[model samples]
Target: MSRALLTALLLFQILAAAATDTTSTRQPDLIKKGWNLGPIPVVAFDSDLGFEYGAVINFFNYGNGSTYPEYRHSIFMEASRYTKGSGQYRIIYDSKFVLEGIRIMADLQYLPTLAAEFYGFNGSESRYNKQWIRPGNKDYHSELFYKMNKDILRAGLDLQGHFENPKFGWIAGTSFQRYNVGPLKMNKLNAEPSPYDESDVLYNKYVKWGIIKEWEKRGGAHITLKGALIYDTRDNEPNPMRGTWADALIYYVSPNLNEKGKGHAKLALSIRKYFTIVPNDLSFAFRAMTQNTIAGTCPFYMLSQIVTVSPRRSFFEGLGGAYSLRGIMRNRVVADGFALANAEFRYKFWRLHLLRQNFYCAITAFGDVGLITQKTKLDLAKVPISEYNSYFSNTAQRPHYSVGIGGKLVMNQNFVISGDIGKALDNQDGNMGVYIGVNFLF
Candidate 1:
């Protein structure tokens, strides 16, 4: 009977059932049932350079399941200093219900004060040691300028089960986080200076499980299976102006890369093929993925993924606002190399309305290629593609190639907002991107 008093009695029965269901029913207009489920408004403005411009607002609400059972809401706001004064105010809530089949969910997040002082860059002040590589963790240069004041609380729970005729799906979850590092700087080696205990606060708990499989027929071939599992305790999840968001770009400029590894067991596999000249918005889905890191270097207090080009950066690996890869700068796709494979080709066009909503817009044409495998195998005819481009001429390489054209809108149908404009035939430099949250990239 105590879990913060049952989450304050289920948030007081959802604000007393949203005030008696807003005076007797009638609030459901979920965008005419395409289901964006109403209550989402966002605004933003940026200039980037000492963080000069800023504005933000995000509000959302979701509820409706077989007649009033699900619920969700979100709120956010921010302001900045040359895009780095780092301000934030947030709130989130989620709910779900199911009885016999076992599927229940609950989530809550709150950030009362999450500030990032950013310390003026070059002339020193940011001081986030180990050079800062946060933006997707790949590039680095430092003069010490770091400031971060934190306040965060998180909550979570999820469960699922599936078994429909020879096919299967599974999901399991657990999460809890609380960290408050109000004033920082810690290191025990290299110049030493530790001891930061002012209720320095850091708590985390995690559990995860995942699996998925598939089959196909109507048009061609298809297959899939997924996986995940994690546990944590190794604090260091700071990223305001970039400096710790996994895939550490070879330890932010070769601190001898792959630091004697850590602890994280990961394994992933995939296979896909769909060839249909024109059926249901044209088709051609071909993918192949192979992930590995069988437990090592990964517990920096969780949340560090952001290794792009895989299901398109899957979950937030780096908190670099915007869905990512927009101009080749965000987690800049790192790793000294270890298993990566990609091949993409997509074309879908329907409705066109770049802005002024009404279902944003649509237009897509894509082509992507990737390859990075060398952990224990490399004899590409005696490694000499000009010494493998002079050892990657300082990062960013692969079979890499891109052709672009992108846009999508369907703030409904599971949600979506996409943008793309790729062109990287070995740095011909052409990447323009914009993505407003999820729905599909997978």
Candidate 2:
């Protein structure tokens, strides 16, 4: 057996032995009451972001333990930084008790990345040459060729209220976001002199060719108003074992701060369903979603942003990477509209109670696929005929596929530590990726 599987088996045996007295009876889960806190040090590594260090703390109020695993209020705080000049500081508050029969969620976040992925628009139409970044290759370019620098400051508030039927609800919210985007800082990225240091990067080339408009090249600020209709019947919020949750959202971006004439409206639809194949021990879950520009033009910088009823992570920019299509390159499929689907089988192989908290470990097998449905309009006339092939493939976009396996360790059914490894079926999407973070992909 592989070392990872062996290690997992050993861990299962150890935990089973530790809970020997409660295994047969399957002792009742401990009921938590009042205020509780779950904090974990953020120590991780990403190929693009470098080593990350910081902390994440979740504060939950269970009130009288009437809801057991469900908390009456939750506050999440995170402050972390990656070695390669990327950092995130965020605070989120969620509560149903804030208003009678209404749920409120709010968040404030600041994210800065020195190297944000920026592949050209539309999937497959933009060729991905791995040789460009290989140091010894004849076609080698700077490793940061496909990257740009970007920082975002965002704040939002959302409220959800049920109709006569509790399963149906309405959501309304507004958010303000400011983005600062530019070419990568090569001086900061390289400690030693290199041949490609002075080479023009993709972002600069796009700006020069007018593919990226000058007005939004440096980024801008905007306010978005959002409304959604939701139908939900999930048994649990963190990792549902049964039921379905679906939502249709419409959001309008107000005119940009720098260009009052620029604005757009978009629609996002998502549906997630969970099936209990073996009660609480084994389950299958799937999510289908599509986001499309309904009216008006979308800025190039904003094309990668995704809209959801409730934001789960600090950053949600992709049709790829951990948040969307696992194992594929991050933000590989940027377009005006896209459709995605993900399916996974989960098995809770072991359960135990320790440190006065309930714990369980699960293994998951999953597959993800997505494609651009509405292509972003690009003006190719400005491109020189001699260099057109380097940037455009003139081919139809197709679905990008990735398959992966993951494991999760859950504490009190609310705090989850998840790790996934995925491989892309097409080389253009990337070879593989390993992601470690909190919560499920949904």
Candidate 3:
């Protein structure tokens, strides 16, 4: 059977299971105590990254059921790889019990991508030609024309402490990250040699044109120190039905470990609100955020990352992609800074007991829009007259928008199985995207 048909069938099965013995009276959520474990096989597909395989395991400690849907301690571990030369391996630990009156979060990750997307700087300003990679087109180049190899080693620690009001908090964190970037590894992909010259690829062309600096072309290592002031009234961290959460964060990247006096400082602001439209069964949620470079210079390799006080995923590099703008191409809006918003309506149609655990099914309809707020400075003087149009659009950047639908299966209201299918409204942002993963994208 085709993947779509298989997915539909599985969804149907889940809905049927949850819909059994449906009733008007709401069932009370079963309080979870002690330690609960959830293990999910990582079987997923991404249009850009191809099929993925591996596993993700989550352990939650409720510590006497006082928090119900919230856990006192949580541990998340995943080991997954894609068929198209990408891999993610990580471990994360979070707990309120680690220190008195404080919450602690720590993570370590290694991500390797043999063909990371590189579509130049700034959204829309950087032209994307579908025909160039189309097999039968006259301008056909290699299929991997807009790709490069990149690997990241990252480790971070964050601490949060509440004020006297408890709703207000302070956050501080430090992280060490290293990026290794270069040309795509054709040998690793086991593909036949390309007929086109090396410069036919955008990365190679950019290097030759001086758009990507030689000192930072291969990537570098840096230490980042960040702090934030936050106000949170959310009832739950995983999925909040009603409340508002906002934070203002500032982070400074120390001078590049490999290059002297090369670094930058940035400011990020995020606000999220949730409204319960129909009590526990339906809700409306929205998040608005912006991140901007406030000082110094930001290298090209670091342009794609979206800094957050607490990262929800292993890869958070995008104004597009699953974590940000669902349907748009991954990292398609790279720039010095950007602004984005997400609005969604979530309706829980079914809730039931499965395998002695409380399970609920929800469907979401969401729209995402974003644009480059601070453009990356590019020196186009090096561009040849003949190739200027192909490399640059010379157009103003505008908001890229997409709309999509998603489904979720929440186990004990903590562990979530989620999927979304989004379509970009503009052809410049590509077509559509299908994502299957964990947690709500907040």
Q: Please report the candidate that would top TM-score against the real structure.
A: 3
**TM-score of every candidate relative to the true structure:** 0.24, 0.94, 0.96
RMSD, candidate 1, Å:
23.5
**What's the lDDT for residue 246 in model 3?**
96
Q: Which ten residues in a row have the lowest lDDT in candidate 3?
A: 17-26
lDDT of 3 by residue, 152-203 (tens): 9999999989999999999999999999998877666653345666445798
Instruction: Give me the overall lDDT of model 1.
Output: 0.31
lDDT agreement with native, every candidate: 0.31, 0.85, 0.85
Error of 2 at 196 (Å): 3.1
Residues 230-347, candidate 1, lDDT per residue (tens digit)? Answer: 1211111100111111121111111112233223344544444445455434444444444444433332222223322121122342211233223322223323233333333444
Q: List the RMSD of every prediction in angstroms.
A: 23.5, 2.7, 1.9
Q: What TM-score, to 2 decimals, does candidate 1 have?
A: 0.24
